[model samples]
Target: MSAAISAERQHDLDTGAAASTHLAECLAVDFATLLQTAARLPVAAVQRMRDAASKGITQRMALAATLLREAGQGDVTHWQSHPSDTVRGWACYLIGSDAALDLPAKLQAMRPLADDPHFGVREWAWLALRADLVAAPLQALPLLLPWTEEASPYLRRFACEALRPRGVWATHITVFKQQPEHALPLLDALANDPERYVQDSVSNWLNDASKTQPTWVLDLCARWQREHSSAANAYIRTRAQRSLR
Candidate 1:
């Protein structure tokens, strides 16, 4: 591990803190230690996660969720409310990996995590179900449309962020890349959103599409500018076309 990771591990060891306050601490968190100390997971369970670390975060998280299920700790509500963000992230994967839950059920279960106060938990929320969304974009898009009008900017951001054509740290949505217009309802709803957080997500969503559908992006931006000339829309348009320019 790097010195930075060592320091973070040592800090958690010394402080016995259950939750991370920022993204770096979230990334550097030692799951084995946290599961043992904060979550009171059994030594065997903790060791499983420790061994899983070598596979990296995504796989580790998936394994953690599986372990939870096998141990009869599959109640996502309990994990979701855990003091540790990593544990809450485990809840996301639990929901994601569950083959029993359909798309609507999964989205309903994911709503709270999608708007989780911790940034890391919020990211895992969308990332957890991203594959399912990609598998069924037609069903997912309409289901997520209402999220754009949600009261919290985080929920609004999740509506777009979760469906980005080429999101970071996740698989691309080929349907959006080839047929970006399918997602226009979502894009249009948030076009004039006041929050910079939501605006950034919208811009990045468009930017992702622009890579494969530049003309579509340009036309959409031009239409938005013509219909609603707002600062938020302008910012989104500018950033969305950054790659094309």
Candidate 2:
């Protein structure tokens, strides 16, 4: 193996040295530092972090979300910063739940950032939210909905994503049942939005909801089909295929 890879492996071994009989240590290393290092660490370092999941450092989990989001810096950035807190929140949510980045405020922070002027922050929040938006997206969703009409396509795109499934961590019956009316307008606006990201987001929402509320989702598809809302039909069809089945 290359020296770089070897060094990384050594670092992980040291940090994760003698995890407990529990297979993880008792949190002696500077977990925050480990997280920062983990972000820049070679892939092997990251794998070590994953292996150390048993150690259960809450801070590292948040760092992992940032690291994962910032990993490649291109299309990853695009998907990462789509215009909502969905990604960031969900990513944070997943990490939080898994015992890595356990901050309640991290998910809460995504709310106001949802209206951020910069697409990067907005996208970060949206993607992070995907980790757990359904459980408490209301904390942020109400704030994001108004922005759906924002002049910025990025903001609008993320707003649409506030409703998307992958955008949120997991689906909640309340998510579909509670906001059906409130989300309806946003759905209509985004159902055939001109921006591919925005339209694709709406498609994902309906597609995911299909599993929980297929009747509404099929009705939505039927309604969209009738209004010549073909803009996202192909994209939605492609994206929603598995969900539909």
Instruction: Report the lDDT tens digits of candidate 1 across residue range 1-245.
Output: 34665675656632345677766677676767766665566788988888787786777878878878887888898889877788889999999999999999999999999999988889999899988998998899999999998999999999999999999889999999999999999999999999999999999999999898999999999998899889999999999999998
TM-score of 2: 0.50
Model 2: lDDT equals 0.52
- Candidate 2 lDDT, tens digit per residue, 142-199? 6566667777676687676755643443334366653454477777776656777676
What do the candidate models score in CA lDDT, each in turn?
0.87, 0.52
Best by lDDT: 1
Q: Number of clashes in model 2?
A: 29
| Structural similarity to truth (TM-score) of each candidate | 0.92, 0.50
lDDT of 1: 0.87
Task: Count the clashes in each prediction.
Answer: 0, 29
